[model samples]
Target: MPLWSLWWAWMAGALLLAILEVVAPAQIFLGFAAGAAGTGLLLLFGLPGLAGSLPATILVFAVLSLIAWLITRRIAGVREGQVKLFNHDVNDN
Candidate 1:
């Protein structure tokens, strides 16, 4: 069986991504971690289509990652005064 067919591998990947998110805390890897977890769950449940096709599984993962990222962004929007607008370059003298 291809490595993708193994659900545990995906879960392991999710765990790694979660760890990265913790280390970075930039709200980036968490979405990917979520996607990996979702894919793992689908594989664990014996999703026939995902189990047989690498491309399809990857596509699903990408879609899930995108959706999760969008949701995360929406939930944790930019904080007030987060943006710093500078009219003059610091090096300009």
Candidate 2:
């Protein structure tokens, strides 16, 4: 059995990432944490062929992370004035 196939490992990683998110509060690690937890659940609940390979598991994690991140971003829309675009360089003076 590969290490990556262990549901506990994924859940532990998810917990750590969730803690990091709490410490930073940037909403970045949260998505990853979600993805990890999802993977862990799938593993624990028995997903067909999920425990058979490493690449497939990783691919699932990546896709889950991306989807979670996108959903989080949409729900948490950027705050006003969060970005500052400077059209002129100060060195131009």
Candidate 3:
């Protein structure tokens, strides 16, 4: 394994998720992609502690994902009445 393989994995995951976001346009996968890419960047930049601990890296990814999700939601809120539409009975169609 390369010394920065883990980081590379994160970056690769980010790339895949980014592609997924493009294919789906759901505003979900992009957030995860951002988080993973951000984590990879942190690793690439030589952050301490995270480079040495798997658990720490996972935790960081989770935290970053959450933050990214919230930011994405804030910046691009659901379309008006989108939720109520989803809640409608499918059988009614």
What are the models' TM-scores?
0.84, 0.82, 0.77
Ranked candidates (lDDT, high to low) = 2, 1, 3
Writing each residue's lDDT as its tens digit, candidate 1 over 1-93 gives 988888999999999999999999988899999999999999999887889999999998999988999899989968778997999999999
- At residue 86, what lDDT does model 3 achieve? 62
- lDDT, residue 50, candidate 1: 88
Off by over 4 Å in 3: 1-5, 79-93
C-alpha lDDT of all candidate models, in order: 0.92, 0.93, 0.85
lDDT measured at residue 52 in model 3 versus the true structure, 0 to 100: 84
Better of 2 and 3 by lDDT: 2
**Top-TM-score candidate index:** 1
Residue-wise lDDT of candidate 3 within 1-93, one digit each (tens)? 444436888899999999999999988898899989999989988788888887888888888988998899988977666775366776896
Overlapping backbone residue pairs in candidate 1 total 0
lDDT for each residue of candidate 2 in 1-93, tens digit (9 for 90 to 100): 878999999999999999999999998899999999999999999899898989999999999988999899989959778887999999997
- Report the number of the highest-lDDT candidate: 2
Backbone steric clashes in candidate 2, count? 0
Which clashing pairs does model 1 show? Answer: none
Measured with C-alpha atoms, the lDDT of residue 4 in candidate 3 is: 40
Please give the range of 10 consecutive residues that has the lowest summed lDDT in model 3.
1-10
Model 2 score (lDDT): 0.93
- Model 1: weakest 10-residue lDDT segment is 75-84
